[model samples]
Target: MPGTVKKDVVVGLDIGTSGIAVAVLNRSSVAIQEPLGFGFCSSMIMEKGFIGDSEAAAYNVKKALDEALTAAGVPFTTAYVNVDGPELVIRHGSVKQAITRRQVVDARDLIKLQQHLCETVLPEDVLSIIQLDNIRFYIDGEYVFKPQGCRGRELGLSSTVLAAPRRQMDLIWQCLRNAGLPPTTETVVGALAVAQGVLSGVERKLGVICVDLGAGMTKVVFINHNMLYKLSIFPAGAGNITADLAVGLHTTLEAAEKVKKEYGLGLIAGDVHVPNISGSGYNTVPGSLVHKIIKSRIEEILDFVKEFIEELDLGASLPGGIVLTGGGALLNGLTEVAQEYWLMPVRIGFNSLPGEEAPNEDAYRYTTAIGLASWGTGQVYPGMRQKAEKGFKGRIKSWFR
Candidate 1:
């Protein structure tokens, strides 16, 4: 192990169903790109979005962290992690408080309102809140971005809360602890993290839909006015497509994954030679059949997303359209299929450093990890405040911290 860097260091860890990604960031100057390293390890210890095997997940987490730290030549023991899955619960609630003491809405009123929301609106079951978004304040009935110092008798607040089962969250924390890395209070939703890494501030402000196509799940997030407006998770992803290919072509899962990476196209194209499941010979299959199988699964997944989006009725509001990210986004012609399916402009999400013209091929897969690092460094949007500061002292300390 190398000596840890003395500079301000931030780490981001994303434990996904198909793999674990680790990103180490060292901020020494204006541009913080030259000293960090990105590491990844293939893993199946996670089922959907929760850890299925704590021991195995811990081992893989250590392996990925070591790889990144070794490359960065620095050791770290803490990281901002990402959480998502079908078991996640999303709730929207509002609370109002009467400012009778001083007849004014101040930091105290805001804190009280937030406390009330958390204590009363959330599910009574054991759950860990991973994200608090879309926090808004109002004076009377009019919305206000900043509610402090207002002469109002009543203060109201509303927020979108995301929580995961406490038992599953404990398992994730144990895995990190066993991996020699202690988890922090900073946890981000997987979809929001991807949006942070790939979608520019302008895009978010103008409105955009970010679809993260992971291995076992796909997350759909709608951002407007630079705030996370909605989030939805589905059980289908690129892994489902690979499974379909394996069964349709009579091939092994491994072979199907290989074929998918090597020759999978979103549209019908040239023929493909798929290996047999018996590991004996190869079979020549028409590209159209392969595309049919792949497209069917892809369409099904996106159909759910489409229905969700249509329910939101965001017609013509999202000028930024939709951005596709995750390992599944790497599938060739994915943007094309998504565009045709949604009848809107779509592009692959890629992370790029300042002054860089093009991003590398693997950038999309690590987008969430990168975003987690950004959050650790406090590069957060104004509207994405995690929670209300306790008091004036706490708010002041946070501003300088």
Candidate 2:
């Protein structure tokens, strides 16, 4: 048998619904420079996290991977892909078991506890389980972070468990396979990667809600006391607003998208003139009407957020405020809208890495991809650690692995 050689490169591919974003990082350096390569493609044929046209999706993924590889000047294959959507499920639970009076608990026992919880609570189709914390354990009725070498007749364990459906994950795996690269790891959407890039220690400890508004989906995670409590996804996104404009104005999607980028506002309070696009005379639509359409969709999306937060009873629990990121977060008036709907202090999320200059003020669209690369190189904000899940957390950790 021949010994396998180690590869010097790590790549992070965010397979989004509206497009594909590929980021390549050099592993030998402590800081990440400009991405070795970056590529994007329109996600025209994907629906609800499934690829409708394998050929189109495969082509996009391949082009992105090839370009990233070329820019990084690395030829070795394999990548850590970020999974976008799977209707993530999260729960907090505790387990209790007896320990020998004189024996010490260890990491292996924690792993055993995790496995036991998985077997007891997770469904058969679960693609991953991330143990967020060992949390505090009750040993002989005394709570402690570490129970090793402690005498106790009873041990209680509490942790966060995050799970995703297996079918939702197959799409990403299949895409990578078609792209001529085996997936080295598969991470959950809006998880450790985003936390690494956007969250601060104070924010995590004081309690914060991170919302990633992508093109086709908006994912949210709530952190309280440095622990993740809630994760949810909404179907409506910036793409939905664009589609609404396209249909309402009877314009081509491209033109509608252009109008959105150029003049779209989430809530227009007064009358505004519509531009003379396509060399036609200025066609006017009521600012209120436009606002109504955009607001309706955005409100629906935020309503989902509210419902999820209320469901988890986290609305009052999170005090660090809300941070919004991802491509769709660039939409005009989105932060204000989120504040009004989510009823929290909202701000745009940015990536801050050592040595690398902050991106252009207007380049919020690339936050995720930039964060993806920064995260891969271990330049994330301080205090973020990879949660524990082989499929999801493991894949996220591999950027540094």
Candidate 3:
């Protein structure tokens, strides 16, 4: 296929565990001309983050990409994609250096500084190092944001590193290639993408946590100073809830999922009353039993999330509170449960792009995919030119290397 670069068109594909979503956007402006196109596929979860059915996954990805590109009236040549799941790993580190009076620093100096920092840490594999804002430069014992052109005696660099298993990344790249699309520029969770799309600048600056309750994974990310401080993904998700319902209700998986969509809630709004099924005798299970089953599964998922947050030692760090997004975020009373568990203010997040028609109130289910596109457009085109440069090269090397 010939490479085509439409000045305004960029595509973002999210290959998730339960389904695949594709979005094509106009990068020059904020308007999303077409909403994302979605394709459903079965995710063969072999392990926490490992996907086993590459052929099936490729088909789903291609279908979504085709529909999205066709809707946007663009053909794929170069596009951004977001990858998520358990394979990726992240860590934070810092480095302190003394600056000489009247010293000049260049790009190489920055690279060397990064290399020196990299040397101190043991990375299972170094995928990318994101330089967080607020590089603290100490000039005569005071911290400053920028020290260039200033007589600084010391510099302190604090940064977060995002890495992933080499083998897992390779599999995703190969899958995308097989589907006739370029590999993703960066692999970020659906949760962080949703956080970027929904959280405000002030909220991020003040420290906020975003929880994305996806189908196969639930991700928690804490952002402060416009950078991620912590992120955790659990294998438990809406799928597990549905599975629990299926087992408890003794119904087919499809039927259980349907029931979950129709009447699912974190907390029962009223008494659980089972409607009579056509083929089965009048449902005998008490409403409280059904409610218990659902609530128990959701609580288990939340418990895992709580444990992860505690592990990160961020209970005291985020003052802006927590924002929830993704399909699972819409569960009735989820915010209340999350607030009680995390002991923070909780709000549900949705896509709010300028000039785009407000999504259906329930469309929070697609938050991650929409946010992936939004983040890709903002980061790849207008926002972080340096980061995009780094991402583009990093993605290429990750695939081929």
Candidate 4:
């Protein structure tokens, strides 16, 4: 029972179209043992980031969560879940607040300024702000790192806001509730969570683009100057490549996926045997053709990233370059191809944060889940606050308004 557990636990749920992943961890700032439990279940209930069937989605979530809890010998009532979907809205805006009686700025003033920005910039009826970043506070017209002592009549704030449609979020909450997990204001952008799991402190501060190449979607998070600069999700991913192979090879999706994992290469090698659409026989196809099909789809996805980079005029500015993770990032020679296309260094990222011990090969699979757990340790979302769970302290303190 939730009341019986003596140790505080942190749970992270990474809901994706390809599967649902859960991580159970000790909620402590110091070094700890490995993850208490980890669980995953293949699911199609979610499609390209949106829940297509609430009933099916809930069932899958429960299946995964139960497995993790059973492994850990602990139970949890809430989890910090990742919100995946293409309908997320990200925008940049600025707001200003006037000081009362021209008094000196303090922590209370800073808090009020943030609250005012949240109220003025967000359309509460249509959109809910999920993450706020790139915030720069100012007194008058100049930037001030420590605004507590500055004396100014006006306070200003500029930030990037990531929001999702209220209707969609409501549906997500309902689905989780149906799974028996109470929904808290605590939530994270999937890509951002992935970055937290895989990126090093130096890498984040130097500037880098973290690309999560999941099965159904490719999510990108840009961190520069130790802050989130952008968050984007494209509707294309490894699943599309599998689909293309399925159609091109006249094979079932299952067979095509197997061929992809076995023979998919960035550059063609030689001919190989491929199973037909039916389970009956095999046929031979040029390795080049397989490469061609895979390359076309991969390029299409990378082109979206390239366009966004150019639009931001971020060319040649990011010293940390690109770090790719997610299931798709496991494809052979993908790093080389990405490096060639962007004319920059590209590397595969795995789960690097502490507290869990996973073989190198399996580390990439749980990158997002580990990151979500890391997000729960000390930092939290701005406005969403709930009373800490029994035996839990400072877990789920971050709230989304």
**Whole-model lDDT per candidate:** 0.76, 0.63, 0.61, 0.75
lDDT: the better of candidates 1 and 4: 1
Q: What local lDDT does model 4 show for residue 92?
A: 76
lDDT by residue for model 2 (1-401), tens? 47653345666666677777676665555443444555565566565556777767778988877765776676644355555554666667778777753556655455556555655566455454422432556776678755666666777776666655666555555665666765344443445567656888899898888888777888887777776666777776888988897667655567667767755555566654554446466566776777777777778888887787777766355667888887677778788778878777888887643223223643454456555555545422112223234433232222233
Residue pairs with clashing backbones, model 2: none
User: Could you tell me every candidate's TM-score relative to the true structure?
Assistant: 0.82, 0.74, 0.75, 0.83
Kindly give the stretch of ten consecutive residues in candidate 1 with the minimal lDDT sum. Answer: 391-400
**Candidate 4: clashing pairs of residues:** 384-399, 384-400
Q: Decide which is better by TM-score, 3 or 4.
A: 4
Ranking by TM-score: 4, 1, 3, 2
lDDT of 1 by residue, 14-110 (tens): 9998899888777544664433787888888888777988999999998988888887777664477898988888888998888766787766577
Backbone clashes per model, in order? 0, 0, 2, 2
Q: In lDDT terms, which candidate is top?
A: 1
Clashes in model 3: which pairs?
Answer: 272-287, 327-365
Off by over 4 Å in 1: 1-6, 32-35, 75-78, 96-113, 136-157, 183-185, 266-271, 353-359, 379-401
- Give me the runs in candidate 2 sitting further than 4 Å from their true place: 1-8, 32-35, 75-78, 94-113, 125-158, 266-284, 309-318, 352-362, 370-401
* Top-down lDDT ranking: 1, 4, 2, 3
**Candidate 3 lDDT by residue in tens digits, 277-325:** 3446435566566678778888888888778678778746667887877
